[model samples]
Target: MSGNKIVAIIIVGLVHLLVGYALVTGLAYSATKKIIERVTTVDIDEPEPEKTEEPPPPPPDEAPPPPIVAPPPPININVAPPPVTVVDRPPPPAPVIPIARPAPPAPPAPPPAVSKARGVEPKGQSRWAARIQENYPARAVRSGTEGTVGVSVTVGPDGKVAACRVSSSSGSDVLDEAACDGMQRYARFDPALDDAGNPTSASWSTRIVYKLN
Candidate 1:
């Protein structure tokens, strides 16, 4: 079929022909026999073509470079300024409570009540005139120097006259002296009473009328 195969067949035919001719002529039989013995059949087999294993290359269309995204660690924006609250300033507002000012000291306790005075008259006051007349100055009666002598007598706590003085002059020294002298000698009174009703010294003022008959 191919030219190389045809050429190889022709060469092998020529070798066989030469060997037969040498044997028939007996020119070199032994040599020819040796040549025939040495001739080996060559098998010419064309090797099969190698198989091509194409088509694993189409996956590289260029989109594999997007996976290196390490960029999200910087967004803190600096908001750390709100932590300074040291609150001890709240004690000043509590002193506004109007301290009740103690009712203006209860009006100074109204000054302990003083007892009202009651009048207490002396007893045996009438006997003073008769006693004073009995001791009238004889000189006043002789001279006819009549006058009303007003005298203040201090009665003792025991109701006897303790002191006497002329409260009003009689225009006669004799009558004035007689009035005080007589009242102090024989006059009597019931001693006055204080608010507690205890006997206290009393002062009595009265007049003595000296008349000459």
Candidate 2:
């Protein structure tokens, strides 16, 4: 029996709480509606959209003033040219220039002198030896008896004896000297020539043979 009493109390408390929540929710909704109605009134006016009118275009410009016409160029009539007067003008004098003549070539130099010692032919088949013998004969020497001496001579272009030396000794100085002396008197030769055909100096050599008996 006590358990039945406690259950009845719990059900009665739930029903009272539900009734309080419903009353509070209805009051809050009514207040919100009243505030909305006051803020948005039916007497408030809305603005109308503005009408836009386009301006008419300016009157068309009078056709551009006609282009100014340029005056025509003056007529060009050519007058007859004045008579041409020909003044006499003497032609310029010709220039006088002296012509130059080339100088005459110098006379060619004389042919080169030849050696007197080179061209001579001995007098005989044994002319060279004969000549030497005639000049020196046999002569006494440091050695027991003297014999003939032979020599060779080199002659230069100036007819001068360049060199004379003993070729075969006669064991005698005197004989050698004699042979050389002969050459100095008898040798003669023609000068040689250069590429230009001009005579050039030259040298020549010859042997002088000497004999005894």
In terms of TM-score, the best-performing candidate is 1
TM-score of 2: 0.31
Predicted candidate 1 versus true structure: per-residue lDDT over 125-209, tens digit per residue: 5676777787768787677778888888887778878888888998999989988888777776667777666778768787888
For candidate 2, the 10 contiguous residues with the lowest summed lDDT are 116-125
**Candidate 2, residues 1-65: lDDT per residue as tens digits?**
69988999989999999999999999999999999999886786789989999999999888877
List of clashing residue pairs for candidate 1: none
lDDT winner: 1
Clash number for candidate 2: 6
